[model samples]
Target chain A: MDLAEVKRIGALARLDLGEEETAAMSDQLTRILDYVAQLEALDTTGVEPTTHPVTLGEAFRDDAVRPSLPTEAALANAPATDGASFIVPRIL
Target chain B: MAADSDLARLTLHEARDRVTAGEVTSAELTEACVARIEEVEGSVHAFAHRTTDEALAQAAARDAARPDPLPPLWGLPIAVKDNICTQGLPTTCGSKLLANFRPVYDSFVARRLEEAGAVILGKANMDEFAMGSSCENSALGPTHNPHDLERVPGGSSGGSAAAVAADECLAALGSDTGGSIRQPACFCGVVGLKPTYGRVSRNGLVAFASSLDQIGPLTKDARDAALLLGVIAGHDPDDSTSACQPVPNYEAALEAEVAGLTIGIPKEYFGGGLDPAVEEAVRAAIATYESLGATTVEVSLPHTEQAVATYYLVATAEASSNLGRFDGIRYGVRQEGKDLLDVYKRTREEGFGAEVKRRIMLGTFALSAGYYDAYYGKAMAVRTLIRNDFDAAFGQCDLLLTPTAPTPPFRLGEKLDDPLTMYLSDIFTIAVSLAGLPAVSFPTGTTAAGLPLGAQLIGRHFDEARLLAMVHAFEATGQGRPLPAL
Candidate 1:
């Protein structure tokens, strides 16, 4: 991956990398990606790719009323809160 | 304490006795621990955040307070892996995104420790978002093995392992999704227990893989580990995923007799890629157990080799979704830019480390349409096979034994350049996680270089008490090795 691609991936990850970090990460990630790409070369046509190694099913609780975190406490550490609601900058 | 002084080496029970008898105040102990950190952390880099003043203040208050008559862990100094949150300390998970983010609430385990009068020392370093097998992926820097400064401590719980080995803390808490705690504990020659999933609450723990993630104890020995587990384990109403099961007296379980027990040795564990030294150490440990009247049965976890691949896919997918909240407007670091999109992009670009980004992309790609069934769905099916492998084996024996890792601690930067080599570190560890079983890594012997070698004992679901008894039996045989000289 190029530095620009690194910057793009970092952007997608919601990070702020400096020029030096971008350059370094680009090189490091390139090698890692190249290694992962080896998985693509395998004959996975007949073989299935594994996701979770444990034999488990979906983990969801029944929809029932339970005590929830109070609004003030829930949003206490939110970076931007306005009147008990998280205030996010508008899209576009 | 001198730099080489092993004064911080006292067991949790011994330290608590000293504090309660007025021989040493909690402040004195915390100071000694902090002093050890100052003496050795420069080379070890075990901690991500050190709360010296906070810990000392808490320790002093604990010293002055009336007795609560709680379990043995009261007033013990403890380090928590950065993935588990503390109210005032930075809960970074060794990732840049949450590097400066402080949780307003404590995890269930942290709160329980405080109620039990244990001092929270600080947050220990880990792999970024607990994604890597080694702490090398940490946004800050790598945590070196206390036994050999040139070698990695093993991770994403490496910091906790190193701290325990260096006498920085009596005990610590680390999360294991795929051997994050056990592998590092093995590498550092400390005791690490990955309790059965849902055994501990994940409320304040940064999630990597929800189904598999478990918060556990890393200590100097099995008895100390049991003490910490006694304080931390059990159900929390806040975490619905936590098991609604009774918390047994783990310490009492330690004294339980272990005669006529059956231990399984999976043939798969002794397969290719295992270092001969590790194999030798593991066999010696098993023989010690056999001497304790335990019989070993050769078993198989046939799908064990596929665990790493399946884990990466499932864990990465969950990590990608879990980390999606840090888009510059929520709980962590933000970087301002021209517009809302630019702001989001730049913040993430600067905040997340490379390893975090790589997992996110890999996970996102795997979960994306047209690939989900082939990658994720298939992996889940394979997971069932792996779990069945354990199910079939446990029917024949009470517990399974394996080397915690294929090799001992590797030199720093040895596998940092290759994700495959790094991923292989979890080869032995991930299988237990895949099977959703409880496993603990205890020091069994030393490598040729005198680094600690550990053997892992995997127990049936919710059978940690039995595992503890078995390990205690082995430890009794004098095979429970001590820390290596740094």
Candidate 2:
């Protein structure tokens, strides 16, 4: 909820909130975090957690080849694109 | 029938009959639907975009080019949840990140519907990235329940439910990840089906939690629901997660009697927090089903308490990863700055809403190297236990019945400021997501305040036929009859 915590969370989320936005979001997020934190107070100590509401398996499908959109169609809306894929600024 | 309300009252089958009989042309039906949208949509906020021209054009073509008798659902106007990609139409998932991004190809379900001659009415609003149970997180605005303008239509698929409830469209497609489809259907007083995961391909759905997401129908009646499901459900070679199970004729199961079926009533669902009115309605629904010849039995799903925590961890983690593609370099929103990192930072900072950022952060924290085992890994283990609980329960009973939500729809902004309360709106629904089983919600009745109440019926994995049969029987008994308030 503090600036430091906000910065840490932003980093973890792969986001970069500016100083002003960070401070604002920190306050807003603090309220939510505080509310969600109440879940910890519940006595789920002996309770086993539930991951799904219904029972099922890994739900895997067989790998098969299907038609892919041609490069022109696939990159139709790309702001910038190379011959076969998207082009972007150098990360380094 | 008043054009303003005629389209709203007609079921998909009825609409199809009229179109085929020349009582109403597809263009007339489409115009009526568009006019209905124009009238009530200001209050309901169900549609994110209204394709009046496109819908009418499609309907006109359906009427003009009918070289043979119309197919089932031919010329019917149906809405699509914004999360499903429609070629040339913006598929925003109610997020700023993809607000302007349009796909070049439609999702399998979207393509299938078009092939079946259903006119694309428009796209309905939803939670940002389909992350929240309440539609409150939508970048546009909260979708109001049609019965009452003040209350929320249960979400991540609130728009679809509201659109159907308000008669904006004959039926709409909704995606269910932790009860996104069923919960809102309950809140809005309509029928929402979450077909067994994989029964419907997830190929073009914008992923929230990939493993749990399934596209289903939100319709005015069970038979319409079956028709919609029949068109949407099937194996798709394009999706690696698509199920190979045969898609049964759901309509054939519609009139099937549930005389000898076993319905399980879990004690946990009727516990302390359930609203008195909701409890009464769901119990009455169960009693009605019993009178129809189905036997009721008490069953236990012991690992119920930890569902919320486990769901958050797993869903957030998967969402965190699935959403990673939204950097400025991708297909949607882009915020310019001096350099690459700045672009990433600026785009995300401006694109994601407060709730989305919160989940991404929590998911990142859970998936972090040091905490993965304590959080995400542990959550997975707990998910297995929950699945096992359902498996054991299914052995004792054919299907499980419970209230769709603890309470009926609350006012739109009531829980907006309280995140936990909003999250808890999905408590009854998340367990079904975790177990990856099929469930549906149908109207039970109304609360004293006049909002709709709904009940949840869950079936064994890949047993959507049985689930639909049960819903069909319930619908026949009129237990889920829509109230007169709306």
Maximum-DockQ candidate? 2
After aligning candidate 1 to the native by TM-score, how far in Å is the CA of B48 from where it should be? 0.7
Interface RMS deviation of candidate 1: 4.2
The digit string of per-residue lDDT tens for model 1 on A11-68 reads: 5555567788777766665664454443443343454433433333445667799876
- Native contacts present in each candidate (fraction): 0.37, 0.39
* Candidates' chain A TM-scores: 0.71, 0.73
Task: Report clash pairs, candidate 2.
Answer: A51-B383, A51-B434, A52-B434, A52-B435, A53-B431, A53-B432, A53-B434, A53-B435, A54-B435
Q: Please give each candidate's TM-score.
A: 0.89, 0.92
Which ten contiguous residues of candidate 2 chain B have the minimum total lDDT? B477-486
How accurate locally is residue B174 in candidate 1, as Cα lDDT from 0 to 100? Answer: 90
lDDT of each: 0.80, 0.83
The true-versus-predicted C-alpha distance at residue A67 of model 1, in Å, is 7.6
Candidate 2, residue B58: lDDT? 92
lDDT of 2 at B270: 85
